[model samples]
Target: MPAEPLEKGQTRFALRAPSARRVAVVIEGEAHPMNRDPDGLYSAEFGAPAGTLYRFRVTTGGGEELEVPDPASRFQPEDVHGPSEVVDTRAFGRPDAGWRGRPWHETVLYELHVGAFTPEGTYEAAAGKLDHLRDLGVTAVELMPLSDFPGGRNWGYDGVLPYAPDSSYGRPESLRAFAAAAHERGIQVFLDVVYNHFGPDGNYLSAYAPEFFTDRHETPWGAAINMDGRGSGYVREFFIRNALYWLSDYGLDGLRLDAVHAILDDSPEHFLTELARRVQEGPGAGRHVHLLLENEENEASRLLGGGSSDSVYTAQWNDDIHHALHVSATGEGASYYSDFADAPVARLGRCLAEGFAFQGDPSQHRGNARGEPSGHLSPLRFVSLLQNHDQVGNRAFGDRISESVSSEVVRAVAAVYLLAPQVPMLFMGEEWAASSPFQFFCDFDGDLARLVTEGRRREFQKFPEFSEEATRERIPDPSDEQTFLDSKLVWDERGDLENAEILDFYTDALAVRRAEIVPRLEGIPGTGAQQRLVGERGLRVQWPLADGSLLSLLANLSEKESGGFEPPPGRLIFATNDTGPDDTGNLSAWTVAWYLLENNS
Candidate 1:
């Protein structure tokens, strides 16, 4: 904790500046000297109440002086480059005191960006929409990162202040209100957090505390966090405290760690392991506090306990299933999608039965073997999604998956995942198929802005369609304000007749899941789930549930009719199309059906 409120209306301010000869707290243009301890931690107590603007002025050993905001600032009212404000975490009161959160097996996630979720793009506006999500049967709402960034708008991966909620959305109290509102609607709130590296700009840790980062380990953003180097104890504690702050102070139900593979560490006890353990012992001791990961490595070992109360992590974002489904529906085999293009239906079946499609299998994209055997992990250990922020926003045009495939194909894919044993997540506006694109957008100044624009265009140059200079130049500039505005969701589109039909389809599928599937998902073992191919593009998968019942899926994922398959056993639970299998055992193109068979044993 960088700042703490003490008795008698005094505040204790602390900063770790080992390389500085002297450090002072600068409040209202006055410099108050702080006492330095043996470990180079400077501390001082002052009579400062909440909302007092302040910064730290440090004099280096060479006699140069500089000022910077607190690294653990709770709120940045004027954005990342401005002075931090004093915030009392206990000031805000939560209305939903009895909210203990939902179980992992009952989670139906609806991922949304706070800035693009509504027309106002504020936390208050987002809270007003909780009723809509509850009506659509969303059990949880997963928000993209809200950390303070350098500019007015960003995808939030470039956050610099880990503790502060970006002021562009609203005050910290607004976020608490948003969570309370969702809890009132029986919706758990989750946040996406980044701990791999600091953002490219507005980070001042290297100036006073150079040991905060190290060149021994490198990442895409440059030198990795000093998690294993000398003076790493405090660095690890810094991140662990940040995680607890969000969970305890803000009352967030869970956290989705972004890109954990890039968090390279050589310590005997990995930072992730220690962080999860601390969280479980701290705020998670009472309620369900889930910890999720987005590791490209597909390390199933990290996801343990089959969604049990004692598990370190609840689930992981299963990208293998997404890629396989994307390739099968869109027939676009470019980039990483090529890994599943050869046998997409087979891969999809594998993901449905087992946890991952590539369990220790060779990956063409990485030129190496990827993932461990995930067959022993329960289906509840995986979170299945068709489109997330990365899947839609990282593209050159940021086109939603609904735009590339037919509505029938979209509905079929939805039915397959929404009713499956694994947890299902939907990107915002995916149910109604909005027309707006979630293009990558940001607000940076001058040279950095130009570099970001050019870097984004350069990333797509390897593709054949973007090989031409003119085509590449047409790519949207991330720094343009219009790029951010254009990504906002069009709320009116959901009311249109065509889009409403799709919304109804999604609503009904989720209703069926809640009523029929979620109750039986608790004790389903990882093994005994089997997959058999009906034809080139047809898949049949079955899983033995906890109640001794067998849940099944029969999907024809092509544009042509698939024949020579036996009718699925048991009663039909849900189907994408109106018609069922014919007497000749042929399913219509782009059709999916789910069935349930009660066990007499």
Candidate 2:
């Protein structure tokens, strides 16, 4: 029989397990013992009203207790697995305003974290920063996940609730407000959704539906989500429903799925394909509903996912690019950095032109062959970024690309990333080069909190600047007001001459894109791409620009050597480092230059 429709403040729930005893509904401020009927539903009445806080406290015979937040709670306040909050999601919502814009290919993607995007660290506060995003020339805002996780502040990846938004960001209504506001500004809102696994805490899908998990596989967190195991069908339904809720109810333009590599599902029908079919045939039929992934393996098959998607997504974040640039620019050679330093600049150029620097190459870091060539897929199906949250936050010292490398190198790489065929993503405060460390910190339950600290430290003990003790010592307290404050963007710093220059450089590049390139060379078939070594520590890249012109990219890898590039006699459009050889033809240190060929057709 179909379940009864819920009215405001009313939720009907049931569990079939006969072995279970002592079931209670956790309502706002108190726990109410449920009345179990032969029909199997254990329910209770609550005067707690709409937007009440709750979670289920279920106990078994052995005195073992499990606290699972409401399976369908509208919000998670304590964290992803923490106490659940009742919210009339529909009450705080409007009609799905719908995406009214161009395709995702033309988008200027901007990635931001709600906690650090503004001082208030809430959805409402993030809404205020939208104007700044607009001024920065970004057309789409790719938010970090808002799914429930423990504590008010987190990176948002450890979310347990498949549907609820973190209450720390504001009520469910505020997310709708953000999406609406972004649409009003001609900007698309792309939400980051994680379905790989739920948080270690407050997870209760197994009790409600035994088929939502599998014993076949496990992830770093714990048991993986039940997508292919028993109850796989319902698990898929739960996720699809959650995604549809965000899109249809909140009016998100797109959803950037997180860590798809960890989504270990072996179902025959395949959940990804089915979800894609449902979405495309639904309200977002005409406009783009991007499904991005952060797959480390670079499996082209997942992107192709049987074409259920419009090609696996508009793009996937290229961690290879980030890693390569980090090693080259920062001169860091601890762990994964080892594989990148030995990588050739020619490989990076091929990635810029063809997308995949390590396609089929033996990856020292992963100890296996990695990635398919970008030539195997559409150029638009990749997102190139020099810096992102995890790349910075997961660091021993949590240093951003801006802090470790010279602004010159940062600007140089930015040019390549923006001009490349793939979509480009910018972390918050990257534009003004704000000095803030987005470290990995969490506030868990008392017993589990200690485990998290020890676990985190143990994972990084092998790395050079990372000791278990040092790692624990630096773990920022999530409850501390200053941790969030430390991540806020200093908008006024743009007034400083150095930052002003970087800001101007970015503006000019983007203006050139909007006014000139978009009109003249939109998605120009990148060609004549060839690169060569200039001795042991330097290399040069040549790109065939318009009208028989050439753009030369130069980088000096060694501390002692300076690199040079000889243009085919034309004006210098931009330079990423020391002024490339002056008119007298003397190259500067680690210079990266873009010069047009004298159009002598």
Candidate 3:
């Protein structure tokens, strides 16, 4: 929760600065000394109403005085390095009164970055497109992070203030209105949140409260957060409260925790578990509130028996499925793709039938065991997709999967995953095969800008394609304004004949998933999915549904036709190329077919 408002328009302001000898709340250029408690918390009461701009002046133990924005600021109107503004959260009227959220089995996520989603690139602008998303069969809109970052333009990962939404998008009430607009259209809204590390710039916690971080564990960014070290209880409470604030105040339906594998904690009660328990007891108690994760470790224990009332997490982004699908479609065997290159068809089958392809298996890329057994988990616990922000933006050119493969191949892969039992997600502009590339762009200046641009190009130096200096220079600089402009989607392309056909293909597939598959997913057992390889690039997988029926998929991923397979048993529900198998038990090149077998006993 944010700072509580007291009677007579007074608000209580508090800051944890145990290492500071003196602290004062600077409101409207007037400083008021704060009283320090035994726990090292400085507190002050002021008659500051809503929209009051203030900063904290702290005198450190070394006798250095500096001003910093409130760590729990509700809104930062002037980017990260400015004064924080008090917001009246209850002023905004609710958008929808009848939105109790939908079930997890019916989630068809459309992930989008608010900046590039529309030409206006504001919360109100994005909300206007809910009709298009609803018409395209998107049940939920998974927004990239909105936390306050360093500059005007960012991917939202480099955010410093977790409580403040970047002002470049819109005001805090604008985000609340966006949620209300989504709920009116029966679309659930989910936000991506980064809890592992803060951005490199504008983080003021270490200066006043060094105990917020610990040198015990090292992360990719820096020293790990003090989750299990001394004075860790308050640190954990800060993040947990942040999560609850977004869900309760903003009326968001769900949250996607980004890269939680880096949130190292060795306490008896893991932070993740405690957060989930608090959420389930909080806002989640009244309505359906889903919690999703992005964990590279493929930890199935956190996702066991998920999407139910008693589960810790609802689902995880299944990178194994995406990697296998990308390797099979494009035949690119570089970097992490090498793990799935040799037998991409087999690996794809395993990912579709079971939850993971590397269940307790050795990962040649990492030179270690990668995952736990996930065969007993329901496929819905895995969120499957072909392209996402990291898969596309991290590339030297930020080329999408459609850029590397034929349209036929893209259609075939889309057919396979869109109808699979796993929850399906689509990257923004993917439904129409948008031509714009989602390049990595930022708005850092001076030395930081140069370092980030150089670092971006250097990351691809190990690849043979970018080994030369000339080739590396061809990669766009992350700080370039044109790079950001080039990434915006061209809405007019949807009306083009070729793009419209692709859009229609996706619409039909998602419609089938909603009408046929979502109804049978409620009580399906986790252990009944099975798979078999048909030929070199052919796969046959099936899952027994809760209603004693069977759902099956047969796919030929290669450009060559595959034979020596009997006709699949079940009534054909959807197909990419043909209606059924040929007389010689042959499936055409790049074809996918889904079937349903009814139990007539």
Query: Compared with the true structure, what per-residue lDDT tens digits does model 3 show for residues 351-460?
Result: 99889999889999989999878888888899999999999998888889989888899999999999999999999999999999999999998999999999999999
Q: Number of clashes in every candidate structure? A: 0, 7, 0
Candidate 2 residue lDDT tens string, 1-601 = 1112266546554333333477776655466787776634467654555555666777754556776766656676566656666555556555444456557656788888887787777888888878877777888998988877777667888777767788788877888888888877878888899888877766665664455677787877677778887546656877887788777767787888788778787777567667766776874686667777787777666564223333545567877777766676776766766677765454565566556677778888778888765555544666888778888877755668888778777776677666554577888778878777776655576878777666666767786555557455675554454655676677778799888888877776665545433332334344455667566545566555444545455555444535344454556656665365555444554555655543363
Could you report the Cα RMSD, in angstroms, for every candidate shown?
Answer: 1.6, 4.5, 1.6
Cα lDDT for residue 525, candidate 2 = 40
Q: List the residue pairs that clash in candidate 1.
A: none
Q: What's model 3's lDDT at 535? A: 74
> How accurate locally is residue 488 in candidate 2, as Cα lDDT from 0 to 100?
69
Model 2 — which ten-residue stretch has the worst lDDT?
516-525
lDDT of 3 at 21: 96
Per-model TM values vs. the true structure: 0.98, 0.84, 0.98
Decoy 1 TM-score against native: 0.98
Candidate 1 positional error at 266, Å: 1.4
lDDT of all predictions? 0.90, 0.67, 0.91
